[model samples]
Target: MLTRRRFLLALVGQTILGWAKNLFAQTGVFLTEQEAPEAVFPEATAFERQVIKATPELREKMQALMGKFKPSIWEDAYTTFLAKKGGEFLGYAVIVEEIGKHRPITFVVGIQPDHKVHDVAIMVFREPYGGQVKERIFLKQYRGKSVTESFLPFQSVRSVAGATLSIHALARGIKKAAALVQAVYQEGKEGGW
Candidate 1:
């Protein structure tokens, strides 16, 4: 002889228990739907801003790598990178560390002065697993490409002996990493920064 109120209570109780069990049993990773709110960053006088959404997978992968190396990047040393409230930010760059076939590779890429390879620096293209990337002929071939080349026909790019695969991956990673920088640079240039 359950009252109507009692029946409703029991239903709620069961639902709560079921939800708890499901929550506790889930072993897979949890993905955040939206990124947390960002802290207030400094503003510029005339420079426009370009912001890109950071995918959860990309964020996680970066975090995992950062945790493993606990490395200190240049930005980390400076503490802040916000431009002054004037048209001063003509270019910006991001530091990305990628796990290549051999070892971790770090590089700097931003909008090029002439638009091809844009101001890309070899930085630390360290590899731990292979030696082919250390070849001179392979390294010299990357000097002339313009950012406008688009790197579409990757096959046209020269390949290193045993380092072909790693070089390709590293090159692609550098391009992807430069995307945000390019956006910001365009904005800054448009805004007269």
Candidate 2:
């Protein structure tokens, strides 16, 4: 009942399906949007979304903080969260992304009012080999890091062997997040939330 032509057609269909499945598997979502904010600010009872635009001045400031390498994934607008507990301001959380090898890796970075990193969480990872950057051991290094601190891998932040590019990407994203929050939430800034 099985002819050669039919068998070849079935084989091709299965191969195509397998390739699609493998491509899907390379992208992983570790946390949802709701969970990311909660994970970064566990004690906060409420979160307020704040949309901030990238003005020319703000972009210059970010560039100064980031040095030579600019974040390629930055957009004209950004959405950050203000976490509060009992009506008291807790901190700010911002989602940022940077290219990891071939794909973008997204992260949620929490910054305290004092401009220090409180916590960090990975929302999505689009690369297959660099998922190790999402591990707690790698993420904990960013805690307490201020915008003035250095994120150089192997110097301040440790590196994962196979995830070197990912480590660099995360370091850039964290620094950019901290800088953005500090610039936007500064006492005399136009849009201080």
Q: What are the TM-scores, per candidate, against the unseen true structure?
A: 0.42, 0.79
Q: Pick the candidate with the highest lDDT.
A: 2
Candidate 2 on 19-111: residue-level lDDT in tens?
878756647899887788888999999999888898889878777766766786776777799999997998998988889999889889998
Candidate 1 has what TM-score?
A: 0.42
**Which one wins on TM-score?**
2
- Candidate 1 per-residue lDDT over residues 1-193, each given as its tens digit: 9999999999999999997776444222121111101111123333233344556544444344323232222122111122233555433333444556545555444433334433333445445343344344544455456543434225546555555545655465445544434433343464221
- Show model 2 residue runs off by greater than 4 Å: 1-26, 187-193
Question: Model 1, 172: alpha-carbon shift in Å?
Answer: 1.6
